[model samples]
Target: MLQVKHLLADKGNRIYSVAPDEPVLAAIRTMADHTIGALLVMRGEELVGIVSERDYARKVILKGRSSSDTPVQDIMTSPVISVNPADTVDTCMRLCTDSRVRHLPVVENGKVVGVVSIGDLVKAVISEQGAEIEHLQRYIAG
Candidate 1:
């Protein structure tokens, strides 16, 4: 089975993070600049929470809260669900589905290594299937 480490190896695990005390607007700007959906809320080196577009739409826009005035901690999802590098893609798929979350921070030795999204997992699965199909086709032609 494909693992999170395998996906990260192919994708180049780069973690984008924001501070909890920062304004939500800043986080939004960073996300836009990176073309990403979420940011890890970090306090120094510790992973404190996660902020996403969904959080902004639901917590700030819906409530008519000013993004510039609001801190990420106020809208960020805390007590994050994380995974290890050795975790299987199937395990991540189940975790994301069961938790109703799109992202999972990869932790190793209590340090954040990378983050994986639902899209990443799906892409990995599709790639794996494609490779298997190619291998089968080669075998059949032999």
Candidate 2:
């Protein structure tokens, strides 16, 4: 069973965040600069919410709101669905499916450690399956 800690270890625990009061445009720019789909909205060391490209599209563009004037808190998804370091990859996948979210922040000891996307979980699953198949093939060869 692959855990989130293992994934974070491979990916590195680097977190990019935006302040809640920052303009949505700034947040979008940050995402663009990082080439990431989402950013964690933080208030100091506390994780408050998450803002993504989808949020910008639906909440800002579709709503005809000005991104420069609109704050990230206005568009960010709050009451975030987060995962623990010990959580299994399957658990994160299920949470993403059930919550209809693409990203999950990894929290341990009340601290945000890293973020994982659906793509990450899928990749991990594929790698795990490949390793399993290789092991089975080796067993059969012996």
Candidate 3:
């Protein structure tokens, strides 16, 4: 079972975050600069919520609100669904699918370690399947 740790090891664990009181426009700019879909909403080392492009499109743009005037807290998704490093890729996939969320913060011991996306889980699963297929082919040829 490929774990989140293995995925993080390959992709590099970097947690990008924004403050709750930060302007939504600035947060969106940071997300664009980083090429990330979401930002962890942090409050002094504590994970408060999450803000994503979906939030901006649905909450801000659709509502015709000014992004520069709105705070991240106003549009952030709270009670974030998180996973652990030890969790298997399959588990992560199920969580994301069931929750209808694209990103999940990896939390262990009440500390945020990294974040994983549905894409990451899918990639890991595909790689694992490819490796297994290669092994089976080698065994059959032997």
Candidate 4:
């Protein structure tokens, strides 16, 4: 099974984050700048929460709140569901499905290393399946 470490190795451990006190608009800008769906809410290297486009939509837009006036912490999802580097892709998938979250922060030794989205898990699974199919085809042809 593919592990979170393997996915991080392939995708690179690049963490995009926003300060908890920052305005939601700033967090949205960061996400837009990176072309990502979510941003880790950090407070001086500590992961406090996570803010995604969905959060903005539900907490700010739908509520008729001003993104520029609202702090990211106000809309950010807290007590985030995270995964360890050693965790399998299958485990990550289960967590995402059960939690109804799209992003999972990868932690190791009590430190944040990276973040993986549901899209990443799906891509890894598809790649693994393709490799397995190729291997089985070669074995059958031999």
Candidate 3 residue runs with Cα over 4 Å from true position: none
User: Compared to the true structure, candidate 1 yields what TM-score?
Assistant: 0.97
Against the true structure, candidate 4 reaches a TM-score of 0.98
lDDT tens digits, residue span 1-142, model 1? 9999998998888999999999999999999999999999999999999999999999999999999999999999999999999999999999999999999999999999999999999999899999999999999999
**Distance from true position, residue 41, model 2, in Å?**
0.3
lDDT of 3 at 73: 99
TM-score of each: 0.97, 0.97, 0.97, 0.98
lDDT string, candidate 3, 27-131, tens digits: 999999999999999998899999999999999999999999999999999999999999999999999989999999999899999999999998998889999
Cα deviation at 11, candidate 2, in Å, is 0.3
Count of clashes in candidate 1: 0
Residue pairs of candidate 3 with colliding backbone atoms: none
TM-score comparison, 1 vs 3, better candidate: 3
Compared with the true structure, all predictions reach lDDT values of 0.97, 0.97, 0.96, 0.96
Report the lDDT tens digits of candidate 2 across residue range 12-95: 888999999999999999999999999999999999999999999999999999999999999999989999999999999999
Tell me how far the alpha carbon of residue 134 in candidate 3 is from the true structure, in angstroms, after superposition.
0.7
Q: What is the lDDT of residue 33 in candidate 3?
A: 99
Worst 10 residues of 3 by lDDT: 118-127
For each of the candidates, give the backbone clash count: 0, 0, 0, 0
**Candidate 4 lDDT over residue span 17-101, tens digit each:** 9999999999999899999999999998889999999999999999999999999999999998999999999999999999999
